[model samples]
Target: MDVLTDLLQRSRARGAAFSHSTAHGAWGVRFPVGAQLAIHGILGGEAFAWTDDAGTSRHVLAGDIVLVRGSAEHFMAHSPGAETVSFLGHPSVGPPGGAQRMVFGEGPGSSTTFFCGAYTFVGDLCAGLLAGLPELTVVRPRSGSSLRATLDVFAGELLDDAPGQQALLDSLLDVVLVQALREQLAADVHAAPAWFRAMDDPTVGSALRAVHAEPARNWTVADLAAEASVSRAVLARRFTALLGVAPLAYVTDWRMALAREQLREGATSLAAIARSLGYASEFSFAAAFKRHHRMPPGRWRTASRRQAAGLASV
Candidate 1:
């Protein structure tokens, strides 16, 4: 798979708390800090979001989406200094087959209607995608951006309590998430992972996909260049410039990441894991894993499990 698709598939979150909320005069909502990511899209009126109680914040007009990356504690309001409330007692409704809604502020006044959602991720996931993102990302679409059109449909779906509404809303959220990520990935290509940044390069992107799709392949830079129909010198120069890593080095890192995941999740033998990642033997794989993770695979697995459990309970 390509880098964007790979990140999305691996980091696709679960048990998301999706809600459509309305705020009229004098309103604010505080989303406390946690690992779950918070996303907000303004459909009507406006809202401002900030990471701190007093810092420069992003103003969101209609057709704008904001991602509170890394789940930093944040506040959203029609105005910056509005009286805020916790979501604990917020009027929320999720009819059996309907989208969830939360309403606040006074009625019959200018209201900012928005959709907000949070998704839970396990195992300290999204290392490549989320690490490349900032503390907050606001997707302000220029013309021809898919995010704006999708927001319109997503907002309409939130209004009705129709059959299969929950499933529909979930699917729509996925679309919005992917679109936003794609936009960000495009804009932040230079700073993102090689798989993401290299996607625009016809030669480098094909090489990236080959490595991800078949981690077992004994891939050299020359092999990848052949796959991309480019010469070795051209591929090497372009790959290093665009992706910030040589092709073979990236392949080794990717292999180790896959091996680590298999070690953490599978009861399969070490030899199997090593063979799957194209290692000649378990001894070689263990030595590489030690270098990548600063610990042997067995110890890393134990420690990683403990850390994951700690994060889950927090």
Candidate 2:
């Protein structure tokens, strides 16, 4: 898989806090910042998307899908001046695998309709990916675009309590979200992480997949190039050019990321973790970890556990 696909999968990104909101004249609903990401789709009449306290707004119309790239409060409204209701921490953020609907304007003339959902992503993978995106991203339909098709299906499934509807809606939402992300990143390739943009180089992409798939392996430029069917010098140049890091540095960073996860889990021996990450011994691993993380692995693990405990109590 390419780097973007691999990042999202490894992060365990999934939908949460879903809602199918319907409204009429003078309506607004605010989705507060807590979800890892949020998606707001305008399935019916025109509306306005209010993104921040600074009063920034974007006009959205029918068939438009907006992906909020990070955990920040945003809203949709019938007009820029509509009264707003907070959806965050509301009882409507319901049980697992189910959705809620909120109707506004309190009249039978519900002219506008939309569906919204928030995403929950685990792990550090989200940080690097979302950092490269603007706070708000909207997808306007174009002729013959598969994104519009997916959004259409998503819209139809809403308010329909047919059998297996939850599963179908989840699938459709994922498709539309992924397509919106792909389109946004494609529009501004520079907005994507360097590793994702690096796929333009076949050798770099191959090497990335190799390192990600078997991070425990002892990887060198020559070894990776041999696996990728490219010369050592070519691989080094291309890898550096695209990822802004040498191949070995990338491997070390990837390994340390894994080590951090293991540390967070707090369920394995330090030596075992080091070995799984391809270190010769725990001593060597600790030294390397200190050099990168600015603290010893054992101490880091302890601190992480303590912090988690504190949060759990809260």
Candidate 3:
């Protein structure tokens, strides 16, 4: 799909409250497969547990951003316990001592507490990226940094519980997810996929921006190379080196993504979408869509809508 749609599909939105006390000792929170990424920010007290996915666990504490890109089943608690729960446990235990989860560094004691959220990806490209990451990504806040302050604000807002509280929390979760993505991208050292690295190359980034900004344009290698102020060969070489795909192929994929999004939104007819994406005929557009997505545009739209509906029900 288009880059923006890819981001949304490979992401999910969720917010949760956690607590701990002497009676219950340790507990776990399980997350199902719908989310591609999850971020846990300590909101209050201290939270301790072995964060595990596929049986490997790491300890998490307050002021830590536990990022689970694999969306694996994991838990946070006061102690590591013998019993484990599936990702779909019901009416889970609240935090200890009847204390609601609170903002970290607020109220009284050094109790560990936090707010967590998860994001599931729906698009193919994003799903691939998520599949490539480790089970968990942890970001410890730097002292006196804006990220730390932002986390504090997030925890504070969560504690308020004002009107439209759920929606507000959802928005905060989005912010946390975006920040985590940005940090992960910056720290990633391995060879990344085209979309992830394209934004970092001057020439390729410019070309990508142009394509995304106007996928309807009649784009050619010559035109894009000229726009990037490079010879055709040099442009092609650099683009492929950085993005791992030829320029034309990338443009074609972007067009397909844009068309898929438009179709799913029911914003335009197939013919209109084809024309707007620079295709001369609806048949030509359908053929391209079939090649990329393995289905005709209409069928893909129906299937995608059905999948989204199923996720909502879950």
Best candidate (score: TM-score): 1
**How much is the lDDT of residue 281 in candidate 2?**
96
- The candidate with the higher lDDT, 1 or 3, is 1
RMSD of 2: 2.9
When sorted by TM-score, best at the front, the candidate numbers are 1, 2, 3
Clashes of each: 0, 0, 22
* Residue 152 local lDDT, model 2: 77
Q: Write the per-residue lDDT of candidate 2 for residues 1-314, one digit (tens) a residue.
A: 56677677777789742787778877778777777788888888888886775367888988888878665678778778577887664445333455677676655454787888777876676688787777887777577889888877787777666767677777777777788888777778877888877776678888998888888898888899987899999989889988888999999998898888888878889999989999999999999999999999999989988988897898
Q: Distance (Å) between predicted and true CA of 309, model 1?
A: 3.6
- When sorted by lDDT, best at the front, the candidate numbers are 2, 1, 3
Better of 2 and 3 by lDDT: 2
Question: Cα deviation in Å at residue 126, candidate 2?
Answer: 1.5
Give the per-residue lDDT digits (tens) of candidate 3, residues 1-314.
Answer: 23433455423333332221121334445545545566677655455544444454556655677777644466665545435455343433432322244222223334565665656543454655665556776666556656666777776765564665556566666666656555665567463455667776778777777787777888999989987888899889998888778999988977876676677676589999999999999999999999998889999888888988897898
With candidate 3 superimposed using the best TM-score fit, by how many Å does residue 220's alpha carbon deviate from the native?
1.7
**Residue 284 in model 2: lDDT:** 91
Higher TM-score: candidate 2 or 3?
2
